[model samples]
Target: MHEAEEAESLLDAGLRALFAADLPVGLALLDRELRYVVLNPALAAFNGVSSEQARGRSVAEVLPEAFPTLEPRLRAVLDEGAELRNFQVQIEVPSRPGELSEWEASYLPVRGADGAVLGVLVQAVNVTAQRRADHAMRRSEAHLRQVLDSLFAFVGVLDADGVLVEANRAPLEAAGIRAEDVLGKPFWDTYWWSHDAELQAWLREAVQRARGGESVRRDLLVRMKDDSRMTIDFMLAPLRNEAGEVVQLVPSAIDVSDRVSSEARFRSVFETAPDGLALVDPQGRLSLVNRSLARLFGYTEAELLGRPVADLVGEGDRARHEGLMRSFLRAPEARAMAGKRHVVGRRGDGSPVQIEVALNPVPSAEDPLVLITVSDIGERLRAQAQIQAALHEKTVLLQEVHHRVKNNLQIIASLLSLQSRHADAGTQAALRDSQRRVMAMALTHQLLYELNDFSALELGPYLRRLTQLLHDTFARQGQSVELRIDAPEQGLRIDLQQAVPCALMVNELLTNCFKHAFPDGRGGRVHLRAACTPQRRVQLELQDNGVGLPPGVRPGQGGSLGFQLLPLLADQLEAEFTLFEGPGTRIAFEFPLPPVEESGHA
Candidate 1:
């Protein structure tokens, strides 16, 4: 009986040691009333209490926040001898208030000697971190799926065997098919390439290559949703793993139908162009030549390609042509090659071909290229030479006509002078006036012929000469009259239409100043000024410091021919003729300059 007592004490001590063992999992024992009977340090800490404080406390008192959930399960284990394994629960504890933590727990009934349940044993593990990690991974996968589906290009993933597993939204919608239509099928059996058996076979091979870590790309023709063919820039590449092994195949494609069509159109236009066209590289070598250019140089397109451009030029001009080509490549722009001059090229037969060349620079990001247009101008040059010769003959004939006109006027002036010698004084004055007028017209023709331009003559020099002639004709031997003329150094010019009338008007006005202004050998100074106005008209002013005009003697109303001719000539020129009241007669007039097309060189 003493030994039995010692064993009972030892057994109690062993039960206490077992419950005190340090472990990460929480352990506890509850009585039939759901009161704490035995609690480990971990289980007491999970309830926010010490073991000594919780040993005799009810579970509702120690963990009030979790009592509602734990009481039912604890009661089941104690009264019905039920056992639970791996049951998951979410609860709040005193240690972390208002925050839920996840736990996985198991409960087993503890039986007495009569097989009746005495208490419940509990085991629990915290699984909050693992649960949170799993939730985050699911969110990331959803985002990645959204991004892949939003792309415009056709994109897909295939297994190592080339069976399609995933496809993006763009290509699926473009073909008016759902993902289920193509997914799980072999890549070559998809709607895009299945229409062409040969293309499908090629695609199968390409997929195999991609699976072997090879990248394949090509421009391929594929059937579209409308059953029409379209061109695509397609690529198949391997998706590799960390070990550098090809794990999956990735297929991508972009629609390139418009680009292919544009290239075809450009080729057609280039081959059928009428002008001789050639493309020259920065090195002055012919990179490409059209049919027209090959024919012009008497060489086939293949024969001209890669040939130096200078080789086509005549031997004498080859060196100069090469230098020009180099200069053009340095600073390229669109321009004529030789201006108006013809370039001489040597044909394949060694014959000379006169041609006009135009140069245009093609834009490039790498090296400069020149587009040269060669035109055979042999016939054109011949036509131009004939035109120039004919023009020269016509000029000579016009000059002769002007010389004859001047001679006839001189004859008339001589005849009038002879008549003046035999007439009365009044009649002699009239005859001399007519002769002077004839001389003025004759001088204009004489200047035109001398200048070899019948279009126009210098007004300043013509006026100076005419005035000097008048001064010589009218100035008396004892008279001391002074003459002053002001004009531009380069001289103002008027066409024949205005020049003839202007000369006649000046002759009349100056004759009046010489004949009527100073009388009986009374000497005076005469000034004539000519200038261009700001309004682009010509301004002329004739002033004299001689006896003023008589009262009431208005110009153009007088009976004399000179006065009568002034207004008529002014009317013909459409000029503004004004007579200012001053110390002497001041006559001013202005007329519009000819349009640029009608104006001539001075």
Candidate 2:
């Protein structure tokens, strides 16, 4: 009936009522020595023991595995009368030996009538399922973040009010910015668009549109952290909830600066090129024409577009041009059309203008196109014609000069021959050699005029003719010396500068063989070969099957005039000359040929 006794009785009654409620919460009361004094059925089940068995048992005896961690906290509460709130722990019960569970517990100090601590009251709840769910949620969020960061594109999440909530690592790193720089700020106010007032305004409107459940996409020029500008293909799409309400905005962007720059450069080149260029569609109709092309045909760009390409040509060639265009469309290739014949284009005023046209195919699978370049060659053709006429006049004058010089040399040779008839024996021989030398010079001029190429002549035919002339003058009447000439049908060409010296050299060598090798009517053979070597040089070899040179008489060291001239001619040709002393004298020389020019004449 005392006041303190009455309060303790009421508290006992409330504890009994709660324990009998059979709730899932674990409740217990421990004595000062941390022994179980009383416990509900739930707490007894948590400890894997009955209430009768757990009562009067020590805390370590009941939960030995968890006692080490819980002993300090329990002592703190019991010794200091402290109230420990919401302390979490893990415990494995005797019934489920390896199965551990999580718990949230609170310990309150129980007081008696004199306000002294009597026992400790414990309240616990199982929170294992909740902790597991929270762990799973964190793992899922980390996985999503990793996936977003791996993307090469910029990605961001915005609240319904257009405030930036999340930005992927790609965009942050690309702009050299941290997430803190833009998170929780308005999307239009971020570094990407804030540099441009007009763009920011447009982006704000676009965000509003997305919030209204509309998707907006466009190419925008955005500024980076370094103050550099780049183009991005940006899009803002709405993310809606189950109730069909827009809850957030997802903004994504991909960098497209390089592609846009390339397109711009191509456009500039197409418009500013000097050649009259036109783009023709697969139908052979002009789709685009540059300013030069429009001016060349005396038509405006508007007038030229969609016009049949064949219409620009003369009427007589229109049908043929159309046919050729059709053939080219079937299998496209790059070629020049003006090389086969003169291409005459008709201007707007029906005047014929000479043109050179080239066609190049553009690679496109869906839409095939041809790039046509037309050059107005009217003035060029006139200039070329004038040059050709002048060149022809000079060629005729050169031929006439060569012919008159050849005739004058022959007259001199005849005079030498007539003088030799009345001179002494030695004088006659000297005059005959002099006459042969003059004749050799004339043969070169004759070949130049006959071949109509004053620049170069084929060495094979030149040597053949020169050798025949020497044989006729030096061979004795009774000697039967046979001559063999071996040379390619083509490719052994020497320029005029080398040809004259080459002719005189061959004349001297053959004349020496005829006069010295086959003396006293002795029959012999002379073989001459000319070929192109792999190292791009001409090789000439002359072998005679007769008495060789005298002992110790090397070529170019003999006392005769022919031997003296050999070294000079070889030097003029930049040739490597050598001789082999054997039964028959073998003389060989090689010299580099000039590089052939584009005209294919050399």
Candidate 3:
């Protein structure tokens, strides 16, 4: 009996020494009866009990919630002398009841010298955070796929082996194929390039280059599903892993076929036109002149190149025409000869000829080139002199119409303001809202009358002024709010169709913030940010740091007039509004900038 007691003490010492090494894993030892013989600090903490309480206690008694699953595994280790590796189980600790946490457990049978199972040794590792991370990663990947599917450009993803793994909706539509037809296939074999052998080879080379960690860009002609041939700007880029290895290839294609065709047509017209055509650079020098222009001025193309356009004007009209040319270059647009007037042109021989010139700026905003179209009105000038008087009368009438429209709108605004004074408070507010709406439209017309560019308006200054007007009108006693405008120095150009609605939207947003945001003389800051993205999308952000919105009041759900009109006006601009609630309220909207409209004199 003395020897047996000494051996038992030695076994306990050995078990304690075995668990002494510092590690995060929970360690425990149990007897054949599935009772805890030893529990280390880690294991004791895992069970939310003291080691003394766990000692000699059965697994079911200590952890009832985990015993249903744990008892079977513990019994198996004892009965079959088997070891279970990396078995996962969920358990609730007594210290934190009802909170289920996952743990990876390993069980091994402990044997005596006679090869009989004495107990089971258990090791457990917590994996709850890792499991949560895996779930979140799956959700993020699904979100990424949704975003890719919504894009308009053709996009495809290829594995390291250059096999197409996934593609967006546009690529499937462009190739006239389903997902199964392209996925898992070699990228070059897709319908987009398979029709052309040379194109297929080029794409294969590009894919290899991308896999080799070099990006490749090339223009390729592809036949679309509609049987229309399109020139696409194709690009392949390498997607790298954390180790900086190219793990995938991302390929994108944009159709530039229409732009190419348009450019070709313009080139043909510019070169083969019968009339004298000259493109004057921003520096007042001729950059390009057609053969007809050179012949009309009695000089070879080389001789006339780089000559100031004023050099070709006759002595009598030189100074005035040069000044007119400067003004046209400054703010150039398509304009015919004002009043059908004629300018005298001097040839290389010093002889003069009467010419009717039409000046227009190149349509591109970046390239400031003036196109001078010269028509020899020498013969028709005398016959059209009487018609010129009538044309002048029409010009004056159009200007008068614009001025009268602006005045009439202003009159309506003034009448609304006057009527609001005599009404009750609610009616006064309604009338005032109507007055502001009228003023927004009136301001747009006022700008049109002043600018004479009836087609579009500069939205940046217009928004600033409108906000200032709103602040001045609605600011109450003892409340101070700073209205700040954050926009690019170059203002956004909005067409007349969208200008009024955009102004009204700004007005509504500002008015809403002024009325409701600051209550009982509270002061804060309001910011109006407007900018145009490189993708030609307009972004508008109106933020105010004041009392946040009501708990559940959303944009389209509010009952006030401002809320009703705000969404309606945003719809008119084709913009989607999103509301962000916080210590303040932020309303943001982004929409594609309206395409530049091609128009003529109305």
Candidate 4:
């Protein structure tokens, strides 16, 4: 073979091998006709034609519609007379799966020999997968674009160089930027701000990580087109080539202004909580201890972190503390974790202090965790001591006052008793009634001085004491009565004002029961019960198994001083008064329990 024939033969062989490879190759050969002297199987198979059909065809013969830019590209190659590799082009071919014709092509150029013109070579790689992928990617890009358009958020994409290559309509419109003005510009160049360094630094880190094959997402403050910057949360990724080298960055952005403000508010509340707060791990160690908690144990957070919670509890309290932690892990929603409870915490010196603890289990404290609030009750204890001192002084003063009042009342009773001896029957009866009233009031003061719960008097105990006093006073005068006082175990506290009136009313009732009902001098049983009903009304009933009320006058109804006092006392108590003489004489006084003067019972 001559050198030229030999070269053509070698060139044809090389072209065959290049197209036979799966990597997609195309070739075009020309003399003066711009025809294909040789075409590979890849180009032929992709075109759905035989090599015979392609060999003699011009660029316009095989694809009439592909000649627009293609003709120009071919002419350029003809004019330039040089080889080109991997230049991108778009062209349409017959469709598969009954869709429109799919697009395909290559970067076209001329294949040449030394010092001579050859034909234009088209390396038509079947870039269908990449093309479809790009189409799908564009559809995805359109979807994101739609979302970004409607939201109030500022969204944008950045290249790896901190340049704002593209922005959504929202941010662009908000910044008053013309669509064409800011494209392909650095983000910081559009606006100047103090936080530019922060944005740039973090974004650079994200780019570096993206380049290294890791995904990066962060929140940052970015400058806007209006020279104002707002906080935003952004996501970025490095777009890799087929060789996996990062050539560009694709990013998504969202505004997080509200989230940042909300987080700041929540943080303020968490840090300034009045109670000692801590995050105790399920393993019994403390993961986080707040400032108040550190102060509670006289240690800094560094000293308490990772330390077992037992170190801050007394030996007796350690087991209890462990049990609580276990309970938190098991149910977390128990009331014990929600309500306050007395506890003991150990100081740095290993001494214990009283505390009231309220615990709440969160899904996460550092995102998820259990929260404990320990209130130091040491000051409360001291206050209680102070209260005890005051109570002691008040008791002494009250006792002295009671003694003097009792003496004065007794003196009046004694004078009445002494005067009743020298008077006529009507006068003597009046004096004796007045004496009973004095004695009733005197006895109440004495009871007040004796009991610690001085705010209210227990009705049962008061009745029993009064019945005994009445029985003792009248026993010698043929007025013998057996008094039975039946009542519940609970006591009621009545203030001194209520106590005096109630006592006087009781005294008169008992005196009348003794004086009139049992004229036959028979023994009797009195049931004195105090009950608080579901409607929050309090009742005191005085019933007897002795004789009923005398004749036409009922117990609380008419003519007598004893009956008259009932209505006055009822009015004083804001009570409904009822007196009936059914079996014996049962008198019940019901009242809406007054707003507690000082809490009725401990």
lDDT per model vs. reference: 0.86, 0.87, 0.83, 0.72
The residue-by-residue lDDT of candidate 4 on 1-602, one tens digit each, is: 59989999998788777656655454445544678777776676666667788778776777665557567767766777644555666565442333334334443444444644566656665567457768999999899889878877566666667676777788677566675676776654554233467656665676677767677787777666557776777777777779887766776667787889988996677668777888777676778777888887899879989998778878887898778777776666454356677878898888788988777887634443577788899999999999999989998988888888989999999999899999999889889888888888998888877875556676667767776777788887876577666655454555667777777777777777777766666777666667777776768788877678767875456777778877788788777878775788888888765556455453
Location of the lowest summed lDDT over 10 successive residues in candidate 2: 333-342
TM-score computed on alpha carbons, candidate 2: 0.63
Candidate 3 clash pair list: none
Error of 2 at 389 (Å): 1.6
> After superposing candidate 1, which stretches have Cα over 4 Å from the reference?
1-220, 232-262, 330-341, 364-367, 475-477, 489-491, 600-602
Show the lowest summed lDDT stretch of 10 residues, model 4: 94-103
Number of the top candidate by TM-score? 1
Clashing pairs in 1: none
Better of 3 and 4 by TM-score: 4
Ranking by lDDT: 2, 1, 3, 4
Q: Give TM-scores for every candidate, taking all chains together and pairing residue i with residue i.
A: 0.65, 0.63, 0.39, 0.52
lDDT of 1 by residue, 430-469 (tens): 9999999999999999999999988877788888998899
Question: TM-score-based ranking, best first?
Answer: 1, 2, 4, 3
After superposition, the stretches of candidate 4 with alpha carbons farther than 4 Å from their true spots are 1-145, 148-170, 178-206, 214-220, 233-392, 414-432, 472-482, 523-525, 545-547, 554-560, 581-583, 597-602
The C-alpha RMSD in Å for every predicted model, in order, reads 13.7, 13.8, 25.7, 13.9
TM-score between model 4 and native: 0.52
